[model samples]
Target: MNNSNKKRWFKKWWGILLIILCPYLLFLVILQSNLDKKKKIIFLALFGSFILFIFLITALEPSTEEKIAKEKKKQEQLKKLEQEKAATLEQETKINELENQKRKMNLEKEVKLKAETEKQIDNEIKQSSSEILLIVSNDDKLFRQDFKLMTNYLADNYSYDSILEAKKIAVNNINKSQYSIEKLKNIKCNLACNNLNEVKAVFIKLYILRIDMLKELIKFADASYGIENIATIPEEKIFRRKVIEYTEYQNKIISFFENIKAERETHE
Candidate 1:
C-alpha cells in the first residue's frame, strides 16, 4: 500500500490497541483495590508498560526528513575530515619535496667543491715540478762558476793558516755588518777593497758552490757500494768536507735571493 495510507492505518489501530489494553489493565487494578499495596503496584506496572510500548512504536517509525537530516550531517562531517586529511597530506608532500631538493643542492655543492679542490691541488703540483726543474738546471752552472772564482781568490791571497784566521775575522765582521739594503750596498763595495774584502768574496763564492756537490756526496754516502777511490783521495776529501760546511751558509743566501726574486715577480 502507499506510505500515507499505511501510516494512517497504523495510527488508527495503535490508538484502538492502547484503549483496549488500558481497560483490561484498569480491571486488574480495580480487582486488586481491596489489597491497597497490590492495587498501587498493578497501576504503576500498567502505566510503565503503556509508556514503554508507545515509545517503542514511535522509535520504530522515524520520519524520512529526520533520517535524511542525520545522514546529511554525517556526510558533511566526513567531507570536512577528508578535506583536512587531504590538506595535511599535501603539506607533508610539499615538505618532503623541499627536503629532497635541499639534499640534492647540498650534494651538488659538495661535488663542485671537491672538483675545485682537486683542480687546485693539480695546479700546485704542476707549479712545484716546474720550479724544481728550473732550479736544478740553473744551479749547476752558477755553482761551478762561483766555486772556481772563490778557490782562485783564496789560493792567491791566503795560506791555509791564513784562511782559518780569515774565518775568525769574518765571524767578527758579521756582527758589525748592518742587515739593511743600504748596508748591503756598502758591503758590496767593501767586498772589493782590502784583504778582508777578498776573503769575504771568496767565502761568499765558496758558499754557493756546495749545493750540488753536497747533494752528490749525500747520494754517494747512501749508495750500497762505497764511494769511489778517486773520490776518497786526501785532496778530494778536504775539498768535499769544506764544501759541505760552506753549503749550509750558501743555502741562506740562496733563500734570500729567491725571496727577492719572488717579490719582484709578484709586483710585476
Candidate 2:
C-alpha cells in the first residue's frame, strides 16, 4: 500500500482494541502455559510493576481543569495590578490639584495684605499732612504777630509803648508762647512728621527767650528812668543778635514745611 493510504496501528479500530486487551491476554497466557511456578510468579510481578508505572504517570501529570485555574489566577493578579496603578495615578492628580489650590489661596492672601498695608500708609500720610499744616498756620497767625511786636520793641526807641507798658506786654507774650508750646505738645505726630513737633517746640522756646530778654531791657530802662538820659540801650544789641538767629531758623522751618508739602502732593 502507498504510505499516504496506509493506516497507523494506533489509529485503527482493531489496534485500539488489541492495546486495551493486551495486559489481560498476557495474564491469561501466563496462567495457561506449562511454566514453572516461580516463572509464573515472576511474570505476574512484572505485569503489576507495569500497571504501577502507568498509574504514577497519570497521577503526576497536570489536568486541563488545573491549567485553566492557574491561567485564571494569573489574569486576576494582572487586573489587580492595573487597578492599583490607576488608583495611584488618581491620587497623584488629586494631590496636584490640591497643591494648585493652596498656591492660589496664598497668592490671594498676599495681594490682600499688600492692599491693606498701602491703605494704612495712605491714611497715615493724610493725617500727618493735615496736622502739620494746622500747627504751622496757627504758629504764623497767633505767635508770629506777637513775636514781630517784641522784635519791633527791640529795634526802635520811641514809636512803641513806654518801658513799663512794653515790659507788661513782653510778660504777656511769654505766657502766650508757653501756652502755644503746651498746645503743640498735644498734637500727635507720625512718621512723615518726624522731629516736626520738636522743631516747633524749639521755635516757641526761642520766642519766649526773646520776650524775656525784652522784659529785662524794659526793667533796666525803668530802673534808670530820669536818672540819666540814655542815648542807646545796651540790651538792644543783644536782642538784635537773638532776632537774627530767630529769623534764620524761621526761614529754615518754612523751607522744611514747603518740601514736606511738595512730597505729600506727589503721593496724592
Scored by TM-score, the top model is 2
Q: Which ranges of candidate 1 are over 4 A from the true structure?
A: 1-41, 52-64, 145-268
lDDT of 2 by residue, 1-268 (tens): 5975677564578756875777555566566556799999998889778878988999987798998998899999999999999999999999999999999999999999888867766676666556656665675676577656655663466433455455666667666656666666666655534555555565555556655565555655565465344445555455556557656766767776676677667767
Model 1 C-alpha lDDT per residue in residues 55-155, reported as the tens digit of each score? 89998976899899989999999999999999999999999999999999999999999898766544543343334324433543554554565455445
In angstroms, the error of model 2 at 12 is 20
Single out the weakest 10-residue window by summed lDDT for candidate 2.
154-163
Against the reference, the lDDT scores of all candidates come to: 0.51, 0.66
Model 2 lDDT, full chain set = 0.66
- Model 2 misplaced stretches (Cα beyond 4 Å): 1-64, 158-242, 263-268
